[model samples]
Target: MAVMTSRFADGLAVGTNLVDTAEAAIRQALAGLSGPPDLVCFFICGDDPDDVGRAGQRAMAMVPGAHVIGCSATGVIGAGQGVELQPAVSAWAASLGDTKITTFALETLRADDRFVVVGLPERGSDDQVAILLADPYSFPTDAFIEHSSEALGSLPIIGGLANGLQGRGSVRLFADGEVHEEGAIGVVLGGPVSIGTVVSQGCRPIGPSMVVTRAEDNLLLELAGQPALARLEDIVSALDEDDRELVASGLQIGVAMDEYAERHERGDFLIRGVLGIDPEREAVAIGDVLEVGRTVRFQVRDAETADEDLYELLDAHVERTGRVDGALLFSCNGRGSAMFGSADHDALAVRDTLGPIGVAGFFAAGEVGPVGGHNHVHGFTASILVFSSQAAPAAGA
Candidate 1:
């Protein structure tokens, strides 16, 4: 049987224009449905939190029975350059044929020993993949993933942390008609459905790999027996003026986790932001929690490097999937206009490389995708979930 899918988009001004625009968009999406939809994935963006909630409610009202899940974005993605500086909403509805959908939400996720995958009627022991969304501000995201891996027992988790404009104030997450804060939610797809994921790091390795001979929490004290900061300075000095300037603006470091092999490639490294440099101590602080005796490398980010890296990753995904019915993107909020100097760069790349498919997603605080067979929180990355229909089962089992 064919996997059925459809997509829709709506945009409006925030103050007085929200209701009208949202109503129109939701109606248009509902009208195009071939039949009743099983799931409705919505994306909303606005300057005000209240308007975002209103748009989410409008979407749920349009499709009462379908499972509604979405999060706020710094910018929303649609057919064109995403609706900017307005209360806008875009939604995609899917008629999941024989697929089982499971969803769960944990408010105090940090304290829980196990996470229950909700929405599915009964839990099965069979292998499953989870598409997760978390509020980065509340949960210790790293710990959550670690504990989830333990609880789920190697089940692959893919999705991103919901983000607001400029990474300050409150962010919004919607389920049904309600908006929540400081929580994580996800959908577990089991049965005949399968998910293909792609994580585009959008960066190229610049320097030689070094071993972390010494370190502390979130700080790299030494690399290859030399002070971490000293090594970073040496690498930056070797680069040309333009590249050096980019490094100085905001440098990043990648640490190879346990899953990666000795010979790591472009996407193998887990990228982390350089938090600060302690000139006196000669230590380098990173965004991630660190430990001693880890492998590390210095990396650079630029337009050319990012574009090349993204294209390469997407090209591989296209080759594997052959043809896709729909795509769900979890792109970093820092990447859109902040990195590309324009919007739709990441979405356009997916469309161009992966062929025309139903694409919908929101910009996230931290992008999520598997690297070296384990999921990690990433920045300046685009994580894609491609969906395709499965073959029908025998008539008489």
Candidate 2:
């Protein structure tokens, strides 16, 4: 039996019969598995009242004993294709051999006006990766991530903030045979199975790296001993018309992830949004924390810049490690038609460069991936997990 079962394709048996759709997805996922799968995940998208939940339940029944987890999405990503605002399901099944995959569900409730979270699993020393999905409307995902950071240590969490309907949200998570309309769900992959991550923040570094000469918490007071806003104006004054327009549309700050590098590059910085500027105080507030001594740069992102950045990162991954078994993509919903001008732009890039393998995921409200070896919530980013497969010596005849 193969160590893992890997297959993914878009458009799973479309019809009024939800059972057929569910069964078809199972067949696609298990096509080449010589033995029973160890884990199964299905991400579904549709407007039908119960299509997402029914498909999830029926899909699990088809693969009895397989640990199944998934959720409904505004968009479904499969293979090298992305189906947006449509009725589609993407299923993935795997056999990790000696690897251990544990599933858990979490919900938040108020106690004495304080929000309390339930369902975080204990992490083992050998655990290396986590696949997380949560309802964006109800779950305090950012808080959960912050808490997990200290507890989980360096374990990389890669997934998305569940995207859904408005007005209480159409959030749904599937664990075992049950569908949850609230909270979060995840699978922790322990033992030797590791997740190699590629986080594309979709921005190009503008201007030079400047050290933060003065700052207080998240408020950036000064860069290179100058007012933070003043430094930004200087950078903008030097840009050409198009790039200046890009900055005008929306600008961001890039906190250097690794300061030891001789030349800071695109991937060196963790891009953050500028929340607000205090002109009177000559300071600016960023989404992420800032410190007095940290090096930083101004960054700009547009369709062309984002496209180039994602391609470069994916190409670098392919060159670094030639072997890939499968991948789980957690992309910001803003990236699909909103940023790329079409669907499947990111998926196609991955498949075109690393294809003939399996891939499945959903368009997320916020993508989770690693930057500088730490997991962080990101916007307009594509957080990918590339499953690396090692070669075993051929058996002697």
Candidate 3:
């Protein structure tokens, strides 16, 4: 497959400015290509909601016959900084060899016994992977992940939720040369191509793993027979004032998979945020639903912890894969500048660990990757798909 990537930034003071900038970027990326691309992923960043959609349309018009899928980002990532606020667009086009591209959209994805996987083309092999872009506001992301796995039958799914303006409803998703408001879209690549995935969930576990003695769906009533909130409070109270404050603000919990025999480690647990505390019920509301019997632990997030965990995951993948040709990063919108207090922290890590290959992607509202051997909608995370060159064929027959 041939891959071409380009970014364009213009002083996007108006909608017209955004359209011009995005058109220029798409044109530049496709300048030397012999034919139309099989797939085009466009990532746009801007303050105006209407302008973002217009810019995306302009980009789609430039790349005919390519399946376009993307969304509005918290900030735009490209060859440099300042593109996020300047009405800029970054795009990556792939010309697949001997591979057929199929695109689909699932407007309403609910749990069912035999529901089809959204955003994935119907006619694909078992080896196909579904790359999804979903709207978190309307869809039950957790259930979507679970049921998608069930319906798709081990076909790995990757991508993230389309982010909006703050917590409002201004997000956008692009497909088939148009933008959408509330839905999911994906493309299935079938044929000789092989795709390798890596999810960098930047979090470290703290304390020992404790089993849930009592719980309900989305609420933890007790851990080890103690009230969930009380147990969490005790752990945070023991820390210093600064640590306590950080924990109080961004408190999270880590749930360990029961099938794994080894002790709980950093990546072993799927990290989830603490949604609310039910003082009357003595229960803790977690971002993810919990089963009656499960193993979990209280965890925290900070720059040092996040950086350490990310580096560890990346290093392990590098050692396993040896080397790579290129990489696509779908990072959480909350991570780069919001979590690290600056931009490019995750990108820099990729460059350092993987030796600077062609990298492109957007800052998604909620990241998607495999956690505990299952696909999940993650927060403050980074999911990377690394493309490596296949070994040459053996000597002639």
Candidate 4:
């Protein structure tokens, strides 16, 4: 297990057997606290879906009064490493002296013409931090995020999808010690605590910026008055052998969040995948929305880019906050050994930058975090939430 202690709380993680992992993590976390923790958040993995509830019960039995939230995951993250697609468990507990911690659950339902989300409670009064675990099957995460962006008003919502069943039967989520098979379970934390977040999209800009001269929703008809495919061909001809190969493997579109900036860099772009292309009209269908006049650029991602982006974000976070008490990492399931070609790439990045801090989380089907001031559902991304005890408000550099 790994533990990071601040003024009031401690963060902890452990991985072993199903129930044993939770019990051990809870004991280690509570050992450093002055009293009962105000909140206990956990993510675990087990071959059997029935083990989820038992693991949660084991953890809660150790910490009687703390509000508990947890979910089942494909793999568990903690102890300065990630257990990719393995049986493991990780828990983050906060003592929270006087911080107000409230746990809640929400679900989305089809409302004929639109979807209506139920069980969404009011936001916390102060600048609260939201941690969420959603069911990939039942929840409309994209629509919910767009709605909550307006409702929560910059309140950061960061978490991952439950991968217990990998979108088959009901996956389990935890709220107040109960295991749920549907909906999203979350906890809103406020008062005294400050949180710094870094959602590493793990991509770097490739080509020069261009304006979308014409488009239809997510379909890009033209770029700088040229057919999208023709523009891409031209750009491809200009690249060296390696870059051309990268384009063939993973070419993405980047939409500039702030077009008025004099210069744009890697983080300035909200990167989206190029789903496919229509040669008949030479249009490109991207994973996100597009408009007629928005500025965009091409981007690429591989192991090198992902490493640089994640570490750069982490080192920058440490430079700003100085010290992090605890961290929750929600990494895309596509990451881990698949992208980085090794286990524990994302979790170890945080440990190398922060030096053995408290860290725990899981591999998610889809990750949720802010990209240029708005929360969006992302894939092949690692979104980190770092907790701080500083008097200053939380900021991501």
Q: How well is each residue in 50-128 modelled by candidate 4, as lDDT tens digits?
A: 7767887787677678898888888777766777665677777766677788788897777889878888668777856
- Please give the CA lDDT of all the candidate structures: 0.68, 0.77, 0.68, 0.79
- The estimated TM-scores of all candidates read 0.86, 0.90, 0.84, 0.94
* Error at 228, model 3, angstroms: 3.0
Candidate 2: segments with Cα more than 4 A from true spot: 1-20, 109-114, 391-397
Model 3 has an lDDT value of: 0.68
In model 3, the worst 10-residue window by lDDT is 5-14
Better of 1 and 2 by TM-score: 2
lDDT of 2: 0.77
Residues 1-397 of candidate 2: C-alpha lDDT, one tens digit per residue: 1113443222233444555666776787787565677888777776763766787788878878778888888787765677777667777777777778889999998899789888878988878688889888888888888777777877778889876533245667888777898899989888767447888899998999999999888889989989998988888999999999888788888988887888898778888998888999988888887767899999989988888888888777766666777777878888888888888798888777766667778888898887887777889998887776753211100
Candidate number with greatest TM-score:
4
**161-202 per-residue lDDT for model 1 (tens digits):** 876654555577777667776577667777776557777777
CA RMSD of each candidate after superposition: 5.1, 4.6, 5.3, 2.1
Candidate 3 lDDT tens digits, 148-175:
7556766667888776554456778888
